[model samples]
Every structure is written in structure tokens, then in C-alpha cells.
Target chain A: MELLCLEMDTVIRARPDPNLLYDERVLQSLLTIEERFLPQCSYFKCVQKDIQPFMRRMVATWMLEVCEEQKCEEEVFPLAMNYLDRFLAVVPTRKCNLQLLGAVCMFLASKLKETRPLTAEKLCIYTDNSIKPQELLEWELVVLGKLKWNLAAVTPNDFIEHIMRKLPLPKEKLALIRKHVQTFIALCATDFNFAMYPPSMIATGSFGAAICGLQLDNGDQSLWGDNLTDLLAKITNTEVDCLKACQEQIERVLVSSLREGRRQQQQQQQEQAGPRSKALDELDQSSTPTDVRDIDL
Target chain B: MCRTMSINLSKRILTALSNGPTRRNLFGPVDREQLQLEYQDSLRKDLEDASRRWGFDFLTETPLEGGDFQWEGISGTKVPALYRSCMVGAVEVLRPRGASGLGSAAAQSGKENIPRTPNRDSLKPQSLEKTPEKTQSNNQSNKLKRKQTNITDFYQAKRRVVATPRKSGQ
Candidate 1:
């Protein structure tokens, strides 16, 4: 058995090929299915027990952090949230199970979207090992059943490239917009307020916000056009007024969240500093002569 | 390669049979989602039975996203049913080994075949000493291709390879 267990180090960990992003047919099909799979009502609006909007926010934020730490592709987190929202819409899940649900959704989403799926062991460790591999596997089946095994629901990231295709920006600015769009999408995933809008609308709003964030010089008359809002709306098949409202909502949420995150960081830093400083003072004041030995000499 | 080709062949057949206005109209006025539901419902038993026999948890693992199975070298097909069934069928037909024994046996067979291919030097008993050196060189080349670069460069490089056809008058 030992002889048979040969170590092969010739494997290549290829970065996911960018060509996958350009599959128009697959992307279009995903878009259609996503529209079909969207929940007709928000989770809060629906009559569900034990699950609330804040619980979703906490779980989503946790999922976002895990995905970022792991350096997963941009699609993984949003797709996981899609699974989470869809499952919550159809099934009544306990608040206690929300984190488990998040983990399983990510496990399933990564398998679908990533070249290497997040393994059960790694996911268990992420949850502080509170959920066992077997339990995660069991719930994986349950979530899949609830989703009716449709895991490729359209995500805002899906629309990023499509929208980028239409936007008239230089390569560098385009890259910035893409980054901003991704951040906006992740931010949307964390807030239940954004769920009411369709994925396409959210994508358009995010794109609009991303462009605004870039503050790209609109001097290129041919590309910038007189009215950016209408162009974005038309591209996504959304109404201009509705697109504006969504974009504003996204900006508002993004601003508040950014402030909130900074505030939390500051508080954390102060709290950490306070405890360490007090410990240092205690150490300085204590005399080293007081020694107690419990051993039987 | 053969595993992938056969999967692709079967998928192509399934899609060519099911796609287009004529086939879509056969189910007349049924919404796409409902039709998909019927398709999965009809195949659930077969899928479950295959899983039970093969001892593979396809029900949980497969994302059921789309049927391309492009990772398996199949494309242009939208039938998850055909792709999965052909995979199970291929596994069953190629290796008659018992379920528990199949994992290692298949792995061993794959490893054994790799050296026996056109790469003849790998098979010579004396060449065993040189194998690690050869694999090391191969690893270096693979690493070169897998170098980490900024996303902007990668995206630009990809865009150059395949200029996305622009929509007219967008």
C-alpha cells in the first residue's frame, strides 16, 4: 500500500481560464434561468419562522469574509448567496442553522464555479468545526433538493462582463469599473434590501455605481454620451427612474456600510490597545520576587 | 481522452435531438422551468438508481447547473440527463471491478497507461532514475504558464486571444 501511494507533483493549478467568461450562450442561458429562479417575494416579506433579515446579513458578511480570505473568484460568494436566498425563500430554516446554510451554499457554489471546489474538511474548519463533514454533506443534499438542484442561478457578476461589453471606457478605467462592480455586488449580497430588485437590475445599478466611483472623465463625447443613466437602463432593459432609485439605494448602503466597517475597525483597535496597555502596566508594577511553587520538593 | 470524447458524442446527440423550434414546440406552451421540472422528475429514479449502484453521490455533488460538462470535454449540450447517464454508463462499462475496488484500480490503470504511451522513455526500467528529473522539468514549464499576474493583464491577454464580437450599434 505504501509503495502504491506514489507522490505526483506534476499537477498544474491553472488559474481559471478567462475564456469561460465569454461563453455567450451559457451566460444567456444562465441569465434566463436566474430570472426564473428568483424568489417572487423577499424573505422578510414571506411568512417564515426562525430566519430574519439581520441573520441573513450576518451570514452573508461571514461568507464574504471567508471567500475573500480564501481568494475565491468573484462569482463564488454571490452564487452562494443566491442559493441561500432561494433556499430561505422556499424552506423555513432555523436561525441557528444559518451559518451552516452559508457554508453549504459556498461549498456547493465553489464546486460549480471553481476549478477546485472547497472541500468539506476546509469548510468544517471555517465553521470552527462545529459542523461535521457528514452533517455538511447531509445538508448539501437538503439545500440542493430545496433549490430543485438548480444551482446555476444567475448572479450579478454574470452581468458584469455583459454590461462591460456595452460600456464605452478605456482598458484601465474598464478594469477599475469591473472591480467596483464586484464590490457593489458583494455589498448587495450582504443587504436584504437589494433582494427585491432582479439580478439584472442590481447588476445595472452596480455598474452605474462603479462608473460613478471611477469618476472617469466623460470628455470622450462618442463614448460618454449626454445621459449615462438612460444608456445603462437601456442596456439592462430597466427603466431609467427605477435604475436611478436602485443605484442610489446601492450607493447609500455602500457608504453607510463602509463607514460602519471603519468604525468597527477603530473600535476593535481601541479595545485591543486598551487591554494590551493595561496588561503592560500590570506587568511593570508587579514585583518578580513573589514566586510560588506547587511542586513537592 | 476517450472518456471525454464519448461524453461529448452522447451529449451532442442528446442536444441535436432535443433543441430547435420543432422539438421545443412538441411540448407546446409549457414554460421552460416547468418543462425542466418534468425532465428532472422523469429522470430522478434513474439517477438515484445509478447513484445507488455506483456508490457515487451524484445527487448531492453535481450542481445540476448546465449540461455542458465542458470540464469533461463535452460542450454545446444542455441535457444533464444524457451527460450524467453516459458518464455512469462509461464508468460501468469500462471497468468491471467491484465498486470499492474501482477507485484504486482505475487510478492504477491510468498511471500504468501514462508511461506506456508515446512517451517511451518513461517506461524503460533504467529510465526510472530519470523520471523524477523529467517530471521536475515538466513542473517548471507548468509553473511558468501558471505565473500569477494582475487581472488586468490576464483580461487584456484573453481579450487579444478572442476579440469578443461587438454588437452593432450598441
Candidate 2:
């Protein structure tokens, strides 16, 4: 059935009207907007080839920070991403203000998923007051209309929770597993390629495969590899691509951060010496005012 | 022979009656007598079922007066009165099999048949009497007037709220 669906989708893509190309253009424009607005976080310099994984790491770190600060559920982040993806699917790029769009998506998802909802004003303030409260509210309506009032979204949290329920691991190992899964999520955001994959697949495949890979790398290859192979067979190509992109981005960001850390250290040392040396040179020049004093004598 | 033909014709008439009316007049007065009869019959069946399920005697006494109903403790505590009332109302509306059979017999003999024309007129609103042209113009005018008010209020409220904070802060 999945193969049939894929075949149908391919056929639909192959025979499309000129007007249908608008969706592709819109997708490209949105991607461009994301690239321009969010960019590769400072970690891009270290691991250039595997930037997506680093991006996911950044996102996971940010999500943890936000969730902890607001006392909101961690699930809200993935829910927000789901809304953003579905909204992007339908709403034409030209009709949206991307910044407002992003913020509104987050705001709506927070309201939908979180047990305790944040007020529109609070969310606006949280975004550094970049947008007015009224504007945020207005964007909320615009977003709802554009997405035709679709509020339900399956999130990475749901996928992770389901997978965890099925796994036969102890609580301590499960906790470690969850942490790795979240880390993979942060890495996912760095990769442009990951945007095309459905959010659930991205979450499940990355975490599931990462756990398997981690186990294998640590020399516990026998059991996990078989389990992972079965898991991978069930996953779609799109999901695998997304996982690969996320992994690549993560590796890239790690490498980039390492380089950035070194560069920062060098810059700090130079910065410390720069002012002192200038002051000493000035003192030397002043003490050499003896030539002028001798001439005066 | 003439008597036999009349009997055959009456038999055909009875068959037609058995089929009932295909289309009902909507605007006429509701058949209250029929409704009441249906409700009573349903109440009786429900009481019977309740008695049977509880291993109690349904026909023995006046059940409405609240004797020690046998099912009271067996069904995990006594049923709430409001829930009982709701269930009774639903059964009344639904008109179960035995209830419908008894009620229809009463309805066939009842004298009050609501006129079809009155029912039709009552079903449609008097506003629909307007000429199609006038109705279209009136709808368009109403829509335009409503649109103006909505847009004005929407913009004014938005501006007022947003402006107040910046003006005070500045």
C-alpha cells in the first residue's frame, strides 16, 4: 500500500499543470526564507559537510532551554514544527510574512499541545517583542484561515513515545535514549533536506537508527543491528533521506563548533594583548621626549 | 357477488392504508395524542425489561411507587434519577417496536387529522414570499452594510489596542 501510494505520488508529480508549479516555487521561496532568516547557527564553521545534524543539536538545545524556562511540555516544539510544515504545504509564500508566520505557528502549536497555554502577549514578548501582540493575534487568524483550521498534528513526541513503549529497555537506558533522540531532533533543523520529510518519520527514524548505530559503534552490534535492519526496512526512502540529512548536519555542526571554539580562543588572546601593547608603545614614545628636552636645554 | 366485490375493494383499501403516507405535511400541528400514546407504551416496555434483567416481578405491583427494586445493588449502585429521566425521554422519542404497534392502533382511531396545506405553509418562512429579484437585491444590500461595519470595527479595535501601549510608553 505504501509503495502504491509512492507510485501514485510520482505519477502525479510527473504529469502536472503549469499552475501546479507554484507549489514548488512556494516551497523554494520558503526554504530561501528559512535559510536567510535562521541560517546555520554558529556551529556551521566546524563540520561543514554534516551541518544538518549540528542544526538538529542546536534545535534540541533550544527546545530544552525553552521548555525548561516556560515550564511548557517538550512536545510543543515538534507540534509547532508539524504546524509549520503543514502550513507551508498549503499557504503560498507570497501571501505570508515568514517571521510572523513562524511565530504564529509556534504560538498556535503551544496553545494546542501545551497543558498550560501562554497568552499571545507573553509569546510576543518572548520573541523579544519583535512583533506586536495585536499583530500576533491577527497572524493567528491568517494562519488558521490559510491552513483551513487544521489543528491536529502528529508530532515527534508522539513517535518517540510510541517507540519507547515498544522498546524493552530499563528506565535509566530509556532516559539516555530519550536524550539522544532529542539531540538528533536538534541536528535535524540544520539540514535543508530534512524539511521535505514528514516530521514523524524524521523523529522516529533518526532516533531509532541513531540508537542502533550508537549501540553498534559501542561494540554491541549483534542484537541491535538485526533490530535496526528490520526497523529500516519498514521506513520509507523519504524518511531515510531525512535521517541521513539530520546525521550529516549534526556531524557538520559538531565539527564547526570545534573550529569556532579554537578561533574564539585565538581571537580572545589577540584581543587581550592588543590594547596593552598599544599602551606600552605609547609610554615608550612619551619617555623618549628626552630628545626634545635636550634641545630645549 | 356484488357484496364479495365490495369486500375485495375494502381489502385493497386496507392494504393501501398499511403502506402509510409516503410524504408527510410538515407545517401542521404535531400529533400530540399519538406522541403521548407512543411515550406510554415505551415506558411500559422499559419497565418490563428492567424487571426481567433484575429478576424482579414486573407485573406484580405498582413499580412507579419505588418498592425495593431488585436490581438496585446488582447494577453497581442505584441509577441516578436524571439519567433515568434522560433514558425515559430517549425511549419516548425512539418509539420502540411494541410501543409503535400499540400507538399506531390508537392513532388510526383518533379524530384529529392536521390539514396538509396549513402544514406546508407553516414549514416555509413568510420571508420566502418575496419576488426573486427583490430578494436578491435585499440580500446584496444587507451583505454590503454588514461588511462595512465588520471591517470598520475590526480595524478600529486593532489600531486602538496596538496604539495605546506605544503611545503610553513613548
Candidate 3:
């Protein structure tokens, strides 16, 4: 009876404090304006021989899975990917070390974003014990050094909340749109093709894509007219043409990502294993033993 | 030829410094305990402040760890340099064992043995301007007195060296 009373007496304080909400101007300033912060490498032209575009995708997927499994904060994975991309831009890392790099980046990012940061031991476990805590500790410095220790360099997720706040939608629809935007942002993180675009552009484009997808699913195109586009472009300070191009790319990836996710889900069911088992197997198969040996040199 | 020769000379000096008695193994095991206590005394407040305000954590929070301390929070434009400087400062004041070990090999390490010889090359111009002729002469005389002994002798006698007679770090 006492335990039941204590359970009933528990107070819920799960919601964010309204007083600590960020100022709109601060959010706008947090958006990456200068091209200096963007990664220099593209899919066609990369300085690192070992780190190909697909490798980035695989690592991003792994990071996303880890974040989801651990129930990390919303901003952790994208911020981690930002650090990974920026670090890879300047430093040519080995393929074997790529997963270690990813783990360390997320470790750094979670520290920055999560109240309870991901532990080094847990991150090593997630890597299937391929790396150790000491290795992660060492590479954290290397990644931080290569990134010039600029861990808070802006990411698309930074602008998502700001953009969502500006849209004229009800609370329920706004929540739905926000969810879609997060998916689009994650998809963009995996693809190196999106690296060239500014984070603001990506955020704006992802938001636009989300609205379109949500509206179409509800059989309502009225919410996505020219006025809405203009409003989004104006809010993000993006040109309409560039915004359209980015939105198109985002939608394209969103479709394929959805399909790929579904296919993987089916495969996991067939294999009767955890979601990560097949992906890890694919990663091992893709990087042949000879390739690993070549990277070590 | 001179540049290469200077490089080789510096390299030999560095190797010598590397092989010298470190604070860790100086008194054998007890030195480490003293060094750890000193490190905590000097760095405790600053580390706690940095950890609370900026989310930075000490590298020694875990055992058998190497490299710079990790940080959290939104990293600022000046943060990397600030963090490096803070670590450098902590290292300067407390003299961590790992940093001493690596500082010998990574020639760019700015923190090791700063009290003994304060990077006269970089400090020359500013110090020359700041320090008057009389003190400068006194420093030179002191160096002459100190130079009769080898660098190792200086290293050995460093703990007993006083700050009032010669402002070495300054």
C-alpha cells in the first residue's frame, strides 16, 4: 500500500522548461553561413584512399543504430556525423580505423548534447569489441585535433527546431512534420552527396520535403503551395531555386532510404537476428581482408 | 648546413632530455604519488570549473589513459585553443607523467620543463624588452655560473633551485 502510494505520488517533469527556450535570433546565428565550415571533399574527389562514400554511409548507419538502441538525444547522431565529416575532410584516416573514428565522434557528440553522455566502455561494446576504450580515448584527441577542436560547428539538426517553429501548423501536424524532418536529416548525414550543401540549405530542404511528404500522405497539397515555399525560403534565407534543388535531392534520398530500411527490416526478420547483425556482416564482407591489409600499410 | 646542424643538435638535446630522470621514476614509485597529489591540488578547481562550465573531463579520470582531456558542451571558436592552453597550463603547473614522457618525443610540446628553461627562443624579444640591462647581466652571470655544470646537473639540482634568486620561468 505504501509503495502504491509512493508510485501515485510521483510527479512528472519530463517536458522542457519554457523559460529556457532559445532566442530566435540566436538560432538564426547558429546556422552555418560561411562555406569555411563545410567539408571540402565530395564523392568524385576525395583525398583519403581508404574512406569512400559508401564507407561513410555504413558508419553513419551504425552510429544511428547505436544512438537509437541507446536512446540517445535527438541531436547526438547528426552532431557526431558532423564531427566525422569535418574531421575526415582534413585528415586521411584508414578504413580499419573508420569505425573507431565513428565511435569517438559519437562519444564526443553525446558528451556535448546528452545530459548523460555515452561511456567509452559502452561505445567499445557497440563496436563489437573491435576497438578498446584506450583506442577510443586516443582517437578522440586525433579527431578533435583534425577538426581543430571545433565540435559545435553547425549541423542541419541545429536549424530543424528553428524552422519548425516558424511554420504555421497545428501542434499535432507540427510534431509529425518534425519527425519526418529528423529522418530526412539522418538520410542526408549518410550520403556524401549532401555534404557540399550548407547545413541551412539541408535543413530548409529537409523541412520542405517533410511538409510535402506529410501533406501528400494526408491527401492535402494546399499546405505546400508557392506561398509556403517562399515563406520557408525567406525564413531560412535560402534562394527558391537552391531550396528546390536541395528539396528534390532530399526527397529522392528519403524514398530510397525508406525502401532500403524496409528491405533491411525484412532481411532481419528472415535472418532471425538483431537489426545490426546483417549490417555488420555486410560491412565485414565489403572490406575484404586484402583491403584491410592494404589500409594497415 | 647550419639549419640541418641546428636541427640535429636540437634532436640530440631532445633525446638527452627524454633519457633524463623523470618525476615519475625519480624517487621510484613515491614520486608518482607526490606528482599525482600535486596535480590534483593544482588542477582540481580548474578541472572542476571546466567540467561544469564547459563539460571538459580529465584524461586521468580513467586509468591507463593517454592524450589530452576530453570536452563537452557547444565548442566555441576560441575553445580549441583555450582547451589546449588550459591543458598546457595544467601540465605546466602539475607536470603529468604521460605528458613528460611524450613531450620529449613531440618536439612541439610547449609544457614540459618550462620552469627550468622558459623557451628563451620564443621569449627572447619580449623578455629583452621587459628585463632591464642590470637584471639581464645578472641573468647572464647566473647562466655562466649554471653552465659550468652539465644540463643533467642542472636537471638534478632543479628541485633545490630557488625562484627568488633567478626568475627562471618569468
Candidate 4:
């Protein structure tokens, strides 16, 4: 049996330029590569159109929930996004298992960004033990290798922070704006156009778009008058179609939450009445018979 | 001629890996030795570059029979044992300076200075300074004092730690 060990010297030579910035051309090439690789297999086809939209939203929501639950930093999200992008870019679709892909991305991101990382076993348990710990570990290495260990991608959060500094908003308002934009990021998976936008561009565009949506909804158009409008327009083209698509996705997620709340309420109401009605029905049926016979005897 | 031959060989290997169909067979036994040598050469170059960037010599020397020892590469100096001891002493003296800088900085700031104490009370709405004006002013003052104390304690502790060893020896 021939054993292969990577030469450490070659490994060092393979180390990517840490300061290499992702240009628009590089970004486009990555997106094109992903498109080519995805439809190559059955598994890739499974997440192609409508199914992909929901999966993307679910993965995004799960990432946020996991971050919040573990008290992990928000930096983990961008790292996760980068991992997801790179994995999708390189690993052909046929080999893709979205569940494993999501878990692996989260695992890699957590390791990169968290000061103290959650172990594979702990993450498995957190994901309801659906994915085995060993599988996650293996997939992490696979994802890392496919990415060529290049982890220097500009993320959406970087863009948002820059815009927030420039925006004349209080900390709380800035946070609110961030939240609104993040809600839109969940829809980024739906469009291949998202792959073309730099993370910073996406973030700035989404934020400015969300602010305008809120202003219009509140019937305060003047709130985002000339200067902010000109600035946002310059940062992002701010097309009506794109903005509406983002807003609709955000509304869909919010509406889904509202529906879930209503469903829970209805379930609770049914549960509360279920036993009482059963007892009442039993009482009505047995009211006049067996007890009287026993007493007479 | 040897250097040229090696460079040519490396280029051929790289091209084979990147574009040639013979990549799977490129790392055969014959090529393995060549690859190993090339790798070592690359590592030596990297280490030399790192040493220069860091402004330190990593090579150590040994005493020879005739009161002379050979030194490796640039910045060659003898007195190996003395150099090692001095480095250890320098690190020991520097550590307390770093700790005291952090400690005094925390103390000089009006905020509670207890390290690693997770203050749950601060999470309460009532304890938080909600007004932007007051919070900004408080943070500014704390930062100013913290900076002043950090510089002062760093030098003071460095002197103390270094002086203590000398005094004990005396």
C-alpha cells in the first residue's frame, strides 16, 4: 500500500496570499463555477428552484438561531456564509447534501470565529442529533479542502458596518436597520444574482432598501430625502424589482412567524378543551344507570 | 548548473501538477527524493525570511575543543548558555509588566476592576445608563484614565520584576 503524506513545504507554498482581495471577476467566476457544478448531480437538482428558496431561508434562520442560542458572535455568520459560498462553488451539486453542507459550514465558521468552539458532538446534539458527529467532522475536512483553505472573503457584515457608520442613526436605530437587512439576506439563496454582488454591496444595498421600505410603509417619505437617497442610490442601483423581491421575502418570513404563533395558539386552545369535553361526554352517557343499581343493591 | 537544473525540475513538477495528465503518477519513488529536497530548500528559505522579519537569530552554537565553535548562518554569536538565560530572564521580567498594565488600567477606569467577573446586574434595565450623553461621557473618562494607568504600570512592573532577581542574587 502506498501512503501519501502532503509535503509540509508544499503546504506552506500552497498557502494563499492572506491579503488577496476578491475582485468582481473572481466573484463572477466563482458563481459560474457553482452553477456548472450544481446541476451535475441528482442531489444538486433537489435544491434548484422552489425547494432551494425554502432551504436557503431555513438554513439562514437556523444559523441565526444557533448563534443566538450558543452565545456565539455574529462574526460566525459571515464566516458561515463564506464557507457556504465556497462549498457551493467547488463541490459539485451531485455530491451535495444540504443538511450536511449546512452543518459543516456552521462547524467550520464556528471554529474560525468563536473564541471557544462547540465540539462536533455538541453541535450534533444541538441539531437534534440528526447528523452524526463523525459525518460532520469528515464533511468539515472535505469543505475545508475544497475551499483550498482560502478564508478571506469580504462578508455582508463588513459592508453593513461601514454604512452604519455613515448613516445618521442612533445605535438602536442602526441595530434595527441591521435586523431588517439580515431578514432579507435569507432570500439571497433564491437568486443567482446574489452570488454576483459582493458581500459589502449586498449589505449596503439591503440596508438602504430596507430603510426606504420602512419609511414608505410609515408614510414618511421625507425621512429619507435627498442626501440619503443620493448616497444609497450611488451605493446600490436600488432597482424597484430587486428591492420588492427582498421586501417580499422579508414579509414572507415575518408572516410565517405570525402564522406559527397562531397555529400554536389554536393548538393550546384545543388541548385545553379536549379533556373537559371528553369528561363531559362520559358524564352524560353514564349519568342515570350503573351507580343507581349499585346503591339499590 | 545544479541550481539551474533544480529550478527546471521544480517548474516541470509544478506544470505537471497544474496542467499535465500525468499528475496521478508524478509523485513516484524517483520523483519523491527530488520533491523532498526541493521542499527542504523552500522551508530553509522561508525560515531565513521569517528570522529577518522578526529581527532575531534562531541558530545556537556549541563549544569546541580548541576554544572555538562554528556558528550557523548570519548574526553568529557565541555564549549560548548566557544568551538562553538572558532570554528567559527578559520574558519573566516582561510578563508582570503586561499583567500590571491590564490590572492598573482596569483599576484606573471607574468601572469595576474585578477580572473575569461576569456582571449579571449590568444586564438589568435599571442598572444600564440609557441616555446617550451620560454613557458617552462616562466611557470617555474611563478610557482616558485607563490609557494613563496602562503606560505607568507597565514600566513600573517591568522595573520591579527585573530589579527583584538582581536584588535576590546580591
The DockQ scores of all candidates, in the order shown, are: 0.02, 0.01, 0.01, 0.01
For model 4, how does the per-residue alpha-carbon lDDT over B1-170 read when each residue is reduced to its tens digit? 32343233223222221221211111112233433453355456555654555554446433223333344453413443334444555555544534444445444432222333223442344333332334434545676687776777889999999999999999
Q: What lDDT would each prediction earn against the true structure?
A: 0.63, 0.46, 0.61, 0.48
lDDT of 4: 0.48
Per-model TM values vs. the true structure: 0.57, 0.40, 0.54, 0.43
Q: Over all chains combined, what TM-score does candidate 3 have?
A: 0.54
- The ten-residue window of minimal lDDT in model 4 chain B covers B19-28
Model 3: residue A227 alpha-carbon error in angstroms: 2.7
lDDT of 1 by residue, B1-170 (tens): 32343233223222222212110111112133533453356357556755655555575654334433422435523444334454555545534322324334334433211222222332345444344334334544566567867689988988866665443324
Interface-residue RMSD per candidate?
23.5, 40.5, 25.6, 27.5
Deviating ranges (above 4 Å) for candidate 4: A1-60, A89-97, A130-132, A170-172, A179-198, A209-222, A225-230, A236-249, A260-297, B1-170
Clashing pairs in 4: none
lDDT of 2 at A296: 12
Query: How close is chain A of candidate 1 to the true chain A, as a TM-score?
Result: 0.81
Clashes of each: 0, 27, 0, 0
lDDT tens digits, residue span A1-297, model 2: 355522121111144344533344533333333322221223223334322333333333333334435655556665565555455454433211344445576678777765345556555554455456667676576566545576665444445554554445555466556655654553453344455555555565655544653453244442264454345424322344445555445444433433343345444555788865555545543543222112110
Estimate, for each residue in A1-297, the C-alpha lDDT of model 1 and write its tens digit. Answer: 355844443434666356765556655565566677676567676656777787787677767767766667788998898888887887666565677778899999988876545677677676666566666776787778777788877888878877787777786556556666777787788888877568888998887766664455365553342267788787767788899888888777765554344345445555778765555544533432221111010
TM-score of chain B of 2: 0.21
Chain B TM-scores per candidate, in order, are: 0.20, 0.21, 0.16, 0.21
- The top-ranked prediction according to DockQ is 1
After superposing candidate 3, which stretches have Cα over 4 Å from the reference? A1-24, A32-36, A216-222, A262-297, B1-170
Ranking by lDDT: 1, 3, 4, 2
Q: Is candidate 3 or candidate 4 better by lDDT?
A: 3
RMSD of candidate 3 to the truth, in angstroms, is: 23.9
